[model samples]
Target: MTTEAKICQGPHTGGQGPSSLDELVARVAACGARPRIALAACAEAHALGALLDAMERGIAQPLLVGDMDQTARIAAELGRDISGIAAVHAPDPREAVQCAVDMVRRGEADVLMKGLVNTDVLLRRVLNRATGLPPKGVLSHVAVFELPASGGTTRLAMMTDAAVNIRPNLQRKLEIVHNAVAVARALGIARPRVAMLAATEKVILPAMPATLDAQIVARMAEQGEFGEADVAGPMALDIALSPDAAARKGVDHPVAGCADILVAPDIESGNILYKSLTILARADMASTMAGSSAPLVVTSRGDSERSKFCSIALAGYLALAARS
Candidate 1:
């Protein structure tokens, strides 16, 4: 099969993508097969609560890999019953992460989730050369957001590499786009409109490298490098999402105003946008790491239980899509 065909293969309804996180969860539940999620260091209350919620919704089957005593304690504190759930005892946090990663490698789990463990610790094991999960390409983070639109409706949008890929160059940025495109396709977007974000739309060479890279990437997209997606580059933030802003700036492109994905120039800008939306705009969001052998849920420890649950659903949906 072609790369595009592989990326776009999945269960979707009537060629329409989900407009909200709840709809995404519903679709995952409707898939009829629960993806097994291995929660590393599963002793944290919020993470456990989220996993329990996913289990109740029939979106995921949890395999707790942590301190069983602590897990039980957290479950009790949250008034949740984990008696029917399966768990492996690994008191050490790193050991728990390793065990969970091993389960994913062994096909016993379809997703790997971070719990009480630190992000760096969990990632070290996941990116380990010999025992780690083999990446399809370079691993990049994709954050999915459901934002309020002009017509009192909401639309799902995505931003990439906010939590990974510190300073992606032209080549690495291409890989990031590929990873984000795969995610958008898995989420039922038939032809994702991708906006390559930079400080400005004008390319001024060495003065602003991001704009040059964005222009080149956009040209590559025009050459069918990113499959059926519409990629336009060097777009200012305002022009990417606001039709009025695009019109005011006279930016004419298919992805100018109604972009489904925003490709940030670097980690700083991407991370800033991510936190701002979550905290200030109060946007509903879900995030996952793409290019891994299996889906990975690595939401911030400060993220709400709802966010964690949605992240699980997002990852679960991707896992099911890969299987189908």
Candidate 2:
């Protein structure tokens, strides 16, 4: 299990962040405690495979919530058993989501995961103030990617509001950046470099509203609005990721090429970039909704079991960090 040596958060603390599935599994084990996960719609066999793996690794103690028949059926098909696993009977998928959220609110679980349920159904349950787990801040998805580095090492980078917040305004972007900063801190990145991404590195308020938004956010960051992060704005992706390109373009900024967090201009760009990395660049990703009191693992239906497992581990890590 190879762990990426991440720049740890805070002035005195330093440690590594998980760079692979195996490494994340190990990090969760090193916590010496398992996060209780309320897994809604556990009937999905592929998701169950991931839950089973996390349980085997001692990172997750899941309360399987959904149609028991489906769960049992999938478990049997996989030649597995939920003998030690506790389950709640929620025949209706929507009701299953409520059941899972209630479990989290009741302190029976520290994390929530979406399984076979629809995204809207699951998110509605999380947003419902009466029965659902309302978030501490605005809900947004932050995806952490592990790209190949020198000596075959992996570098952990993050992109925010990718799966949520379409066409965010300046205020919404502030929340998004704050959420991403939390993820960076959880990954042990003290003062993570943040790049406010746009088409060009120059700001043209009328023609490019995104650059203006980026400029405002960068100024807010300069004023210590987002604590402990080096924020720079209106940077092209090339300048944000490639040091050589930054040098060639004479973009003299601390976060120009060494950015760990990228604030995309819009959800369209964010989602496209996320899928491109996952599918085209072959980058491994673990994503979840940030700003929730307890971590919420939300993977797409098309995501692989490895992705699900990684998401669970990431949520568990977030849970542990929150507790600390």
Candidate 3:
């Protein structure tokens, strides 16, 4: 059986994600691939650094779209050599996004990454039905996290639509879950445990829209909508993550204390959860835009190079999966 199949069927259900970014990188290496990535507006240090690292590690082959001269200068400043890195000059940031997006559409690139360009501009191309990257479902942000081992197993946690979907309704949430589950499957989690996050565990009608929606979504999962994944919902953040909290609250769920995916209530709560983990909890995260035919690496300015590289690795793994 493949790793994913084993994950879904393996007797050990002690919840394991990757222990470190090293594991993700190792998975990419196992694919024996260097995914071609078209990075738009490649003028920022963070983005370029990430690309350089990925290239060095042989995880990605980058096609830089930006001012070639400026990108070369920045590379020199960063103490890196881009003598062999393929690049194109778009003369402007927006046009650079166009160039990168066009590369993906042309099959010259397996992945599209955002560099120095504004997110709105990059997204305009990504969401453009005529020219944008096509997602498998709805475009949603899937941020992967490698949590510390809680019992000799490193748990991988994923949060969805943290930076993309705004106020996702029931249908949109379903799409978001599918999108995230696709990502989880890419990461070798066959039957990922999904927890639909809400304010509380109560399924009060009309009073808690999120809870009600989550309840229905869990039922849909029970109906085998999300493959072999275990889906639970109408639970608070703490109840979803902390077994101790779940027990204190008398909540016993297979997904509780071991959720692979956390379906946020909305973008507000999703963003807050994502930021809290990164900024305060000192978590390492890899975020990418999924639901497309191609994976898009998206990161924050405040993100570390490791995070950005993780995003690249995430995209690489997904791209490899699609090809396979």
Candidate 4:
């Protein structure tokens, strides 16, 4: 049977959403459709390895746009066969990125993955007004983390704008929240709880600008601006995740302790928190650019093969969900 035929035969539950990365992959496996991924400048070993793994697991169908000889060499070095995969030769990195972006814009690909090219190069092509993927308002990065809880369990949490939109203003933050909530909903969180992070839980004028923005966002949430999502702001990091800390701090809000999403005040704090969770706490994460025409996988070069594969799974699932 053909790959598409086999995928169409997979079972569909349309039931509970995934709570962990493993479950997320399983959900994608059960989606009965494979998202077509276009990898820009796909000469990198780690990125190719992850895409190969994803293809083997039926999570993605990859279209490689790069130096085909280098891709074949890397695949051979990794002892993986790429005979069945499609390739578009664009030896120049910029050309490769533009080709990949054009594929997405033309609906030839469902997802976009960054490969050997620099991020700015890839993003510049993607943000090109005429030949790029048009933004749904603004482009932002959302990192989904599977963190270890108190017991021997793990929970999924999302952090936003860690890699994009440095120093976003109030309006931009609102757009970021909307982008994140869309991702959370795509992941099956019916009503995500959002925590706007700040140094303290108090809005001190002239000192903490983040607190002011957070307070305004929280009020907007109360006014039904963010749809079904629950949002709170001016929450310290400890109060955002720890119920015990919330209790001790006397923070009586719906999203104080159990926030499904954390919105950072700036890129520095967001990137630090994201890296801390990955490097210090040893959390597993999958990240993608939200608010794009299609799901975009932009994992860091320092990220593991597992991280890249999981990112493909996340993006694949989102692509399938968007189709549904």
Candidate 5:
């Protein structure tokens, strides 16, 4: 049987209203994979909770690396059973990050999960030239969501270099968009509509280079330079997310009304927009590192329990699909 046929054999439980993160994880587990996951700095309470949930549901076999004593204490506080988990003793966050990277590099784990480490510390090891799991290259974060308003079908939005690339130029932006489009394809989105967000709809004179770059990239897509996506950009945030805003501004573009991927011009805008959506709008999120040899889940400590679990589910599904 084909991979899509296998994936479709599962019950249609997603893309409905108020989809559960656990249910997403369960469906991924049903896809004939129980990925071995490596957790770095596994002493944080929330991270431990997510790992515990994944373990209990048989979605992942976690090889946890951190301060063993601290891990035990945190696990006890969370009432998590670590009886069968493999705990590697790395007392510091940097060391734990190295251990996690080495696990994946050695073919012992399929995915990497971050815990209580500093983001830079974890990234330094992962992007280290000599010992990283994947080669040191462009790493971007794309957070996916299954919003109730959109029904059960999953929606993907990406903020380039949000957690990695600080100030990307036009070339880096192309790489970022390509990474996000790969994620869209992995989620079964055919010809995903991409909106390159700008401060305004029009490419104003001498205001921002991003708007000009957006127009250029959209034309690139039209010319078949970029593959498998309809890319339009230099759109305002309001128009990108709201059809009414687009209609009022007389923006006649397919992505303006119904964009599947919203691409921010830079890291600050993307980070601010993502945090605002989560903190203010109560949007659920599942984030992973893209443009790597494997899917990486580095969920924030401030994330909701549901978000953490959903990220694990997303990583699991990507790992399964890679094998498929």
Candidate 6:
């Protein structure tokens, strides 16, 4: 969301990048156990297809929670075989969401994946006060992307409350950071460096409270607020991405160059930035709602097959990593 300088890579006008799906899948496979995942609204064509693919690859053991008859019909239409798959029938989407969440609460499923259901409906069950997977306020959305130019190593970036919190205050941002850091640790990142993004590197007057919040977050981290994570901020996007840009601008932050995570100011900026990267830049990404008792894969139905597959792997990774 920062008005930072545009980042340009060699010969690629639109964004060029390596997908993290393959890498994540490989990691899951190496764990030697197929993680159990529950699918909400599992009857959709894309949803069933992706679940089948994940099952066949041994990355996930899916507990399909939706209209079983409709799931079968969709699978049949999609030329998928549901012979060995286990499913729990829920006639309505709202019930389906609760079924999936219930599986997680009961330890029947390790992760939660949303299919054709509206995110709001599914989230209502997840955020239910008396009965839910985790506490009400801890849920946040995290997207992990691998840049093509960067090769091999996976880069972790986080945007908070993209699908949930509209405009978070300063205290809420701390929770967001904590949630993001937990996700980073799940991805095997040790001591992740968090860069709080703003429109500029310096905190300006009356323009962006985010800049000041970034500074405050950094100080909080210094005071042992966030364990094992280094936080720095009020940085523009370019400064976060390009080490050279930070040096040229006389910035001296640990996360200036090679930042592992970029925390956006608000939902508007975070959502817009994510969409820009996916639509305009052509970034291959997978997102999930995390910080709950179970990971929730909440990719849109419009997402590509690759995106869905990556999200499945991500959910499985978190599930497996949690065990370790």
TM per candidate comes to: 0.93, 0.92, 0.91, 0.94, 0.88, 0.89
Task: Say what the RMSD of model 4 is.
Answer: 2.7
| Model 1 spans with C-alpha error above 4 angstroms | 1-10
Whole-model lDDT per candidate: 0.88, 0.83, 0.83, 0.87, 0.76, 0.76
Candidate closer to the true structure by lDDT (higher is better), 3 or 6: 3
Native-to-model Cα distance after best TM-score fit, residue 167 in candidate 6, in Å: 1.1
Candidate 1 clash pair list: none
Candidate 3, superposed: residue stretches over 4 Å from native? 1-19
Worst 10 residues of 4 by lDDT: 5-14
Q: How would you encode candidate 3's per-residue C-alpha lDDT over 29-50 as one tens digit per residue?
A: 6555578899899988889999
User: What overall lDDT, based on C-alpha atoms, would model 2 receive against the true structure?
Assistant: 0.83
Candidate 4 overall lDDT versus native = 0.87
Candidate 4 per-residue lDDT, tens place, 17-136, comes to 677899889878766577889999999998888988998898889999999999999999999999889999999999999999888887789899999988988888888788898686
TM-score of 1: 0.93
Off by over 4 Å in 5: 1-23, 135-137, 147-161
Superposed by TM-score, candidate 3 places the C-alpha of residue 293 at a distance from the truth, in angstroms, of 1.1
Question: Count of backbone clashes for each model?
Answer: 0, 0, 6, 0, 3, 2
Give the TM-score (vs. native) of candidate 5.
0.88
Q: CA lDDT of 142 in candidate 1?
A: 95
Question: Model 2, stretches more than 4 Å misplaced?
Answer: 1-16, 19-21, 150-152
Ranking by lDDT: 1, 4, 3, 2, 6, 5
Which wins on lDDT, candidate 1 or candidate 2? 1
